[model samples]
Target: MADKPSTPLLDTVNSPAELRALPREDLRQLADELRSEMIDAVSVTGGHLGAGLGVVELTVALHTVFDTPHDRIIWDVGHQAYPHKILTGRRDRMRTLRQKDGLSGFTRRAESEYDPFGAGHSSTSISAGLGMAVASDHLGTPRNVIAVIGDGAMSAGMAYEAMNNAGAMDARLIVVLNDNDMSIAPPTGALRTYLAKLVSGPVYRGTREAAKAVVQKLPPFLHEPARKTEEFARSFFTGGTLFEELGFYYVGPLDGHNLDDLLPILENVRDAGAGPILVHVVTKKGKGYAPAENSADKYHGVSKFNVITGAQAKAPSNAPSYTSVFAETLIQEARDDERIVAVTAAMPSGTGLDKFAELFPNRIYDVGIAEQHAVTFAAGMATEGMKPFCAIYSTFLQRAYDQVVHDVAIQGLPVRFAIDRAGYVGADGPTHAGNYDNAYLGAIPGIVQMAAADEAELRHMVATAAAYDAGPIAFRYPRGDGMGVDMPERGAILPIGKGRIVRQGGTIALLSYGTRLGEVLAAADRLAALGLNPTVADARFLKPLDEELIARLAATHDVVISTEEGGLGGFGSHVATFLAANGLLDGKTRFRPLMIPDRFVEHASQADMYAEAGLDRTGIVNTALTTLGYDQAAMTAALAKI
Candidate 1:
């Protein structure tokens, strides 16, 4: 009789070797248990629940079959690596996912031996894994290197480039195509169509195998023609003549959830040595749970939720999110104008274009995981006299800098960029944080830039960007909920490069941008109580300099305190450069640029990150008082008023 399946199956199993030690039937049950545990953990912590749940069977099978740590497994985007983390030694610390000092939401090389390659951005896995494989070959220390890439990520040119190169080099790498047919939103484009063809044509595989047997005996000289005939036959059946042309051992569109299918295929590939191989494993986005399967996007990334009800455990708040505000404003504007079209790179919900897409389906474009393509596509639409609003996150837009400069800015097209997550994004960490958008966009020629202070300002900025067809314009807004300000009934555009003075003062001038205005206001109130009246101005435009307003404030006040939510090469840096280049710093006015210091800030709550960067209200106030030569007593008095 077989012994009762050990509790040690879940508990004592820290690594892949331990997992493999269990019976094959036990391993299958372990996959089910892992899925259950993952769902429970994610329901409480609220992370990438769906993707992780979908990859449970695949994850268990891969780790159990392959020699991990030594055998590198590169998870594309790393969102689905929760189960992988749990199976490894990180099971105990899984609760600390995405916390300041805890495990990351995605895979991290530093976190565990399991995570061989770190990834937050998609389409990088294949290249990274191929490099590892090649390096292993060069060192005479051969080991298996597997890249688990998603169907969503396959839309990008870089993934294809990696596949193209890997196929040519014939690197002994295993490429697992985890096809859920979605990337936040449903996948799009010509490549997606090609993958669909690969799925539909099963007969092509048997035909190719039969032809390979014939070609092997064809005296080496006649082998090329037989191979060509097989390739032509495959092209006739499957539209993916492209993959064959690149020379890869393409496998299947197999059931990723079924252990029976996944186990044997993975074993075959692991043992079958030489040449880059592509294993297409089709999966449901949210596999075990019914609710997640129905609403995959909603479950893609979630806040804490009730497991029983499958309801999100949202905090009671009346304040509207910045994303909702942007969506509403886009709908309002698009309703008024026919030419107004919206575009996003696989982030319809994140960028708040779902309503726009629903309202005007023809006008909305969901370019799947292709930032570079989205920017240029928007540029293409703009040239045809259509107003294309490229709604992309700040971090993702960084991928399209060249397109912005060459295609849009150089041509002076009306590509309105709705840059969301314009500051430090919480939980998801540094990779997804929209920190550099302001600094980078400001540097581009023939571009107009603005940062919104609140939801109302974001509306106005969106309108401003839409109306000003003079050139490419971008208005950035932070993540999370707004300050619950009274939103405008109708949208109106603010004057280009003009700043609004929030408060009047005597000694110091506080010039701030975006959400940093709130901090500046707090500091001003604190200073006012200490008998140092500080005037505040919201420098709306980072480019076009707002030179007149900045110059006036500088000449009028003894000190100018510039605050912006970005790093050294950001708004404050630009302000400092302007003051120095314009010869404004040499005189009585001393410019103090309060910006994010030169360092990569770690994962934390946005508030905590702001405090660390000296951009919080207290930090901002203290800096202002110190610049004005005030003691602690004076600073305290200033704080009393605020």
Candidate 2:
């Protein structure tokens, strides 16, 4: 573990109440100490670093200015909520961030009262905060509802939709547009800070309200001109023309890092008589730490790192990552096909499309933080006879489910969905877990769904997705390094709806889907030692089920087990349905399906989560042994060996 930083002021303030108790002048020192403490905790825990570092002052200011737990502050996506977590009496538990049964990486409503809304996904703060504000009005318990969202989050249509509603409703809500990454409105130093304070203050707000009241009394002809003049003057200086048009009284692009600037502006907005207000505050991504500040992508996240050197500890891997393999394979496909284009929702690097962009700059489109737009945008390209590859994480694709169903699936567009981050994502927990794609996509008709069993299989799937221009086709792959397998010269397309039998055996048969084939093979070895030789088959395609291969396995073997790294209604359910329909499960062949359990698997190592889900080697072997009705005495001894 790295050496801990000294945080005397931070140590004193465990909660926002304690923070509010501190003198106004002592806040800058408190902010400094808070920054040091956050850096120290995250250095050990290894989570979202730069985002939290950027919002240290803002977190401090909010906690200091507002009555947190009473006054609702919703952090959008919660990338920058680590500091907020620390200040809200969770300082000691900060070390356990993102671990199993530990504090969540994002703001969870169950975790603390300070977190009014649970925010794991981006661009949801505004909508959620609006609901709370409306609720407060109804309950007659007035409290400030503040939604702190990054400027990048504003790219999503949901944010604007919420803003439009808030404006129409005229709800007493405060939106702090954390203008950090996006260059929406650059801060102009002291002048910008002054304007923000002036506009947010009672004097300016009262004057504006009075003028509006007087304008209402005037003739209907002059109202339009007066409103336009006032809007134009304010928006020109504050750069919030769009927000003003949406019915929000806009503040400034003030310095987010400056406690003095942020404190008064937030206070003004808090005490203001306006129905809805939007404050724009600008800050650096990696505000305090030099390493994150100097690094590219602002060192957004990191593994366990040395505090002094900012050197993250990465485990050495022999095999290439599934993402890189996809990128290389996609690049190869693009080289042959000019029509092949890639699209990502603000995740060029995450999807390995950054490398693709380097090779074919014109072919890659990164629609910022807009998954719904990204899906429909790719569908538009496919309509024009262009092969569009929509590379997105499985978790993020949930946002564009409607687009997948209506735009692409219903239209039968030949859009290739390169679904990354399938199965259990270790530290990101259930929110980021890509477990639903198999079931979600499987439910839709006229679409080809597949999962790669290994690195080489991934290459083939990429090739298969690229080659086929049928309806919509999707292939799922996990997050980490692939199983070390020999490289193929080029991926050759495999026959659809067919499975390959890896090992042929007698009584027991194991049919695996996706990466769980590796675990099934390992379980088969252990079963072989226990006087049971099982057949192992990799079911490559989830959709267009391998009817012939599956029937053969069921007819030949007495017991067949179907395993998948998905929920109940995924590959296993599909296999079970096929067996029941064909009367395959009526005779000697009894089938046992293994999949992720009904509940959400929390943050843990991939190996550990699979074990818990009963999809690992030990879990599979134990399941097979129990299903075969092994003697209790014999099973206990057999279990010890495996």
Candidate 2 residue-wise lDDT, 1-642, digit = tens? 556777887789988999999998999988898888888888887888888888889999998888988999999978789999989989989999988778889988778988888877899999999999999889999899999999379899999999999999999999988888765779866887898999999999889889999999999999999999998888888898999889998998898888878888888888987489998888788788999888737378788888888888889999999999999999999999999999999888889999999999999998999999999999999999999999999999999999999999999999999999998898888889998998999999999998999999999999998889889999999999988999897898988878899998989999999999889999999999988999999999999999999999999998899998888799999999999999998999889999989898778888889999999998899889888888888789998875
What's model 1's TM-score? Answer: 0.92
RMSD to the native, candidate 1? Answer: 5.0
- Summed backbone clashes in each candidate are 1, 0
Best by lDDT: 2
Candidate 1 contains a number of clashing pairs equal to 1
Q: How close is candidate 2 to the true structure, as a TM-score?
A: 0.98
TM-score of each: 0.92, 0.98
Per-residue lDDT value at 566 in model 2: 85
Residue 320, model 2: lDDT of: 97
* lDDT digits (tens) for residues 46-135 of candidate 1: 899888888999999899889988999999979989999999888888878888898899998788888888899999999999899999
Evaluate all candidate structures by whole-model CA lDDT and list the values in order.
Answer: 0.83, 0.90
